[model samples]
Target: MAQARENAVSEAPYYQGLAKSMMFTIALVSLAPLLGYALLSGYQYTTAYKEKVEAHLRELVLKHDQSVDSYLREKVAEVQVLGEVVGGDRLKAEAEITSLHNALVRSHGSDFVDLGIVNAAGVQVAYAGPYPLQGADYSNAEWFQAVKRRRVFVSDVIFGLRGVPHFIIALLVDVGGEQWVLKATLDFMAINDLVEDIRIGETGLAFITNRAAQFQTTPRRDMTGEVKLLHNILARGGEDSILGRGRAAITVVDDPVTGREVLFVTSPLKDGEWFMVYQQDTADAFAALYRIRNVGVAVLLLGTVCILAMAFLLSRRMARKVEVADQEKDMMNDQVVEAGKLASVGELAAGIAHEINNPVAIMVEEAGWVQDLLEEGLQKDDNEREVQRALTQIRSQGARCREITHKLLSFARKIDPTVERMCVNDLIREMAQFCEQRAKYANVRIETSLEDGVPQVEASQSEMQQVLLNLINNAIDAMDPGGGELDIMSRAEGGDVFISISDTGCGIPKANLQRIFDPFFTTKPVGKGTGLGLSIIYGIINKMGGDISVKSVVNKGTAFTIRLPASKEGMRCAAGNGAAGEQPPADGGRSEETGG
Candidate 1:
């Protein structure tokens, strides 16, 4: 018991290691492809989604850039047309300017906030609409100086004399050899509406800024904290620096104030004097991509959980089965030891038989001499007749002892493993009679019901002997302490020979029936059973193309049935050798029963 415990403890680590190895193998195989696909697909989708968003933002910024530029150019052209048609001489008149402004307002709505005429000295010479100053000073104004050098000029948004945020379009005119500036203030709210309408998802909005980083139009969101960041972006000198370029560019940067990554799409406007930029938070722009990524991670996590669970369960189960098989193997090794002992006992029996043979021969010769002496003294006397009878009895008993010694030597000799065709009924009768002495000692009854025409089987004689002996011994052991009947039967049916050995003994339980033939499985007490007998028998029969089965009822009896294919060659040999005898009566051949 202690040794068994030690062996079990030693094997625990081996089984645990096996289980762990299996678990890791299963997990790696299952998760490799899943993780690879998720990562690969995620990378591809992110790249595509980001490119799509950048393209869309770039297109949006460019479209609005054209609209804002067109609005500025149209205002400049209107001012230039007024200067040319009204002739700077008439423009000197305040009434003529007022009538022209009213006509322009009637034609273009409030987009034309007000109109004015400024001389080369930067002083307003004529004014129209809203403000009261007809001669507002303009000598120091930036537009006055710019207009003197350019035919048309669009100014950045500034709080001018009106103290309101607005920009103006001015056209220079030559009136009687004098330079005159025709200026019209554009409605700041009108241009601001153009940029305000360029809204996208949450946190996405557009605004316009000049090269000086001054806001030219109102932004939809607060821009107080982003002024420095915008200036730095305008100062950049790469493809995304669109300050003086005609094409739009895109960039992504971290917002210093919001501490979030932002996407910027910038386009040149108003002859590169201003920039139309559309900025949006990157998270908001790619919200759908992030959502899909989140869902994929969730699914991957769930798959990992399931894979681990199955791996653990299957590995543990397989490991348990392996442990059981190993234990059975150890038990089979013990049975091999038991078989070795039996072989030694057979050798001892052979030695005894050799010794007894000589003695029995000498005794038979001496008894023959005594009988001859009695015969020589043959007389019609009672003494002489008694001597003759006694001598006769001694000779007959000596012959019986010699015969038993010869049979013992034959049985104890080494077995031959050569395969041969042999009659099944003959082997059955031999094995039954061999066990008759043991049965008698146990007060058991032995019976035989063999069909006369049972066909011969082809198999190794020694293996067949072992199979029958083991089965008979098991039956005898089952009936120990209380003798029982042992029945042996043989029949030829369906091209096969059937043999059955039954015993009225303590039978096997239903639960153990299926495992009875398994190596190392036994209900017998420890030393009394090695548990390999039935398994070896099963294997031998299977090797000869035969099969065995069993049936039992607990507390009643057990029956083992064997089926072997009948040999056609053996049948032909029997016929050629004239060994085929007359068939028995139709009542199922011969039956015999003998009490121990």
Candidate 2:
């Protein structure tokens, strides 16, 4: 992944040039209608905000419709089953309704207002549930009449014989020319419960309406619980929206009866038989903009024009600045080349250090084990004992040489490599231990709070360690006397782990904090830094699928939080402060995929 290439693109003409000015003028002139149209559309939709409340209300209505349809269809299906069971005996039909009506009430709850059945004669022979309409003649009802002729019908909301707000769902039951009308009446109260989920602010109402503007559901605001409607415009045979059409006309109107001005937003629903109308108080919708008064509209339009003009002016100004920027960019490129040259030299330095240190580390561990065996009386021969003693000294010197090499390689590009899954907590702890002598010399104390079960992450061990150590060293260096603390902590989050390192030393200046991560950016005096430490650390952390953000208050301290992707392959690398941040050398380092 060559990042340099990601930013490479063909240049465009500068905005201050005559050609750019002409382009801008043309664009601004050509775009006024588009801007106006966008604003108008936004204004129309946004006016519906409080009314719709959320998308869930619309879904609830559709879902309730489906459920009701299914329930009625189930009853129609049962008619066939019951006809088979009774075999044309009207006497058994009443007894069957008694049993099934009780079952329906128990299953569907008290929401149902009426459950009744009629014989082929269309007289309600048996009825159950609250508001019993027994002995009533639903046989001539619109839904009943339709069902008598073998059609399923869902009649519009009406007051049943029980005088309850309910709708009739009926279907025909035929067995060998004998027939009956099976009907279910549902209370309008159920829809009130559905509408209750919508929230309306002060002086606002939430309600539903049919395509013809008949009320279907609304908030139970009044005690009467009556089915109310905008009755003036609702006509059974008046103008209706065409089917398959959506977003019909919306208007602010007085209900003529209620005399309330309402902003209505309607969506075609149930195949245009109805429209889901979400209405709110028109007064409340414009309440927020009241502070503007009569001059508001004029000011808004003027401000919009001024802002666009200012933007064009800003672009024109930037064209002049681009030339100066181009010069600075070239200077920066020269610096990059210079840095690359230094890096080439650092590579050689790194090669020498690594080649000299690897064998030394192995020898040191081997000799330590051998010396332990000798002390445990494993070696009997005096020559062997003498040889082991000599090897011990050689191993100690070799280990010292390895430490020297590590110190030399610390400032090299090969030192702080890229990241992989590693135990971040342990890595920070090792840096604390490694910097112990440095901290003592600088008279600073390092503390740690490594959270348990913190997941390992793909990160650069050396880079993160160097970052902590650098920040800690910076703090130690910043302190006047002795009392200061460098605290490091690591904790696991969802798919990432956060490592925070804070210092109790004097805080950074507000002006410098933002630029602290920039390349060669430092607040330290001459000879104290190359200033690439934090910059390199920043680059490495970002490259490792992680981010580092610093928060500081003057007179307090700075805390740097590094978030990394959790994974496991970098565990050993993190523990050893290995070259985990950089790509492995073409022939020298190992490669493996880590489990995240």
Candidate 3:
């Protein structure tokens, strides 16, 4: 873990860049759709909501227009009935007209303000209720002229002699072959109430306007600036401005007065003489829509923040893991290079051993000849003792040289993977002997304990030899400079063969103990170690169905233990091969101690 942190620090820039790239990628992928959905859904909702509001306003104006028209027709019908029932004679009488006006007021609420009788000259001969102008001349009045042209006439709101806003509904009657107008004043406030009743959100109200853009009904608010704007709209719109479009026409324009966008719903009233209009500020109409949009934007922002945070953390963690893996890969590559160098050294040593073999054989032959000559003529005690001792030393040194060369040659041979029976004790003894000279040079002692009648294992002999050689060499190397004791032991118990090699040397630290068998992990100096010895040994043992473990204490010693399953077949085969069917040697179980 410490190593991993060091590596991360060393490659900080690389990991940081990786994290940044991943973070952006994650943010883009997450936010793109969210933003798109927000925009699309918001647009759709806004359009639909606006259409709904406008529709509601249009319907309200249309319904109120019909009500106003109906009110006017009822008043007209009442005037027509009075003229026909009372006849022109009674309608001209003040008392009769007063009785008719009172009856209208009682039956129809306050919709009717007064009643009057008009001659062909447009003179109001008789008037009843409220106003005191009993004989007003209407010879050129618009309603009087219009009523003469038609059987019934409902005038636009106007302030006639009484000087108040009201409209007159008049009926033309043929009384004794002469035309007279039966007129009734409709209450303007009654119609105004109908328009005023239309109320929606803030800034929503309705009013009635004539063709000249004159206000017929009292508006809820001042509409002086709106009147001129309406004049232009009605002028350009022509006769069917409101009716031709549909039941009601809707438009949105910036108000000249408020300088704010306003929605207008207009419908024709009284056969297009007046228009019922519903106006509202657009902002107020869509307040809920704008509110929902704001909330959605807030939620999107919050989600974006969460997505970015997660992306940053996740990317950083992933990059950290990648950095550690890269460090491990680099270490593995270095180990491979070291193993290659070790291979080259082994080839060089093999070549040197082959070259030295010829010369050593020639030297051995010369020593034998010298010994033969000394045995035949030398008789003096001092000279004979010296000559005999010298020859014995030469032969002994030559034999040692031959043994060393033979062992090197055997190790140089290619490994055989074929499984075969092998005695664990013998292999341990052989490795101990092979490392004995190196131990002597280091001044280290070699000790061996072999159990007699130990069970054999079935494995490749070359691989077993390699495993033992690696362990033994490591033990000798550990006890270098100032040598210590090296112990190799073998035993059989519980259906398994166990081999342990231990040495008293500068021990491995606890931090490195677990990683000792890992490839490319070593405590030795760079050039002196391949870091693959124990790892290779571990692989070989495990391949042959065996296990290997280690234990160490700093400045004390280290021990490696190997366990291989004992093969009963191999033991039986060994027994069958014994010479003359003799029992195995008793000395096999003995512990031998050798020192330099």
The TM-scores of all predictions, comma-separated, are 0.61, 0.35, 0.59
Question: What local lDDT score does residue 148 receive in model 1, on the 0 to 100 scale?
Answer: 75
Sorted on TM-score, best first, the list reads 1, 3, 2
> What's the alpha carbon RMSD for model 2?
31.6
Whole-model Cα lDDT of every candidate shown, in order: 0.78, 0.58, 0.77
lDDT of 3 by residue, 101-120 (tens): 99989998888898888888
What would the per-residue lDDT of candidate 2 be over residues 462-555, giving only the tens digit for each residue?
A: 5565566566666666664665777777777887888888887677888998899887787767854667767766766776778889888776
Clashing pairs in 3: 452-589
Error of 1 at 423 (Å): 48
Residue 353 error, candidate 1, Å = 4.4
Candidate 3 off by > 4 Å: 1-17, 232-244, 343-349, 352-596
Best by TM-score: 1
Model 1: per-residue Cα lDDT over 247-365, one tens digit each: 67777899999999998877778767788888999999988888988999999999999999999999999999999988887677546634833743453354455555655666677
Clashing pairs in 1: 122-138, 122-139
Scanning candidate 1 in windows of ten residues, the lowest lDDT window is 587-596
User: For candidate 2, which ten residues in a row score worst on lDDT?
Assistant: 587-596
lDDT ranking of the models: 1, 3, 2
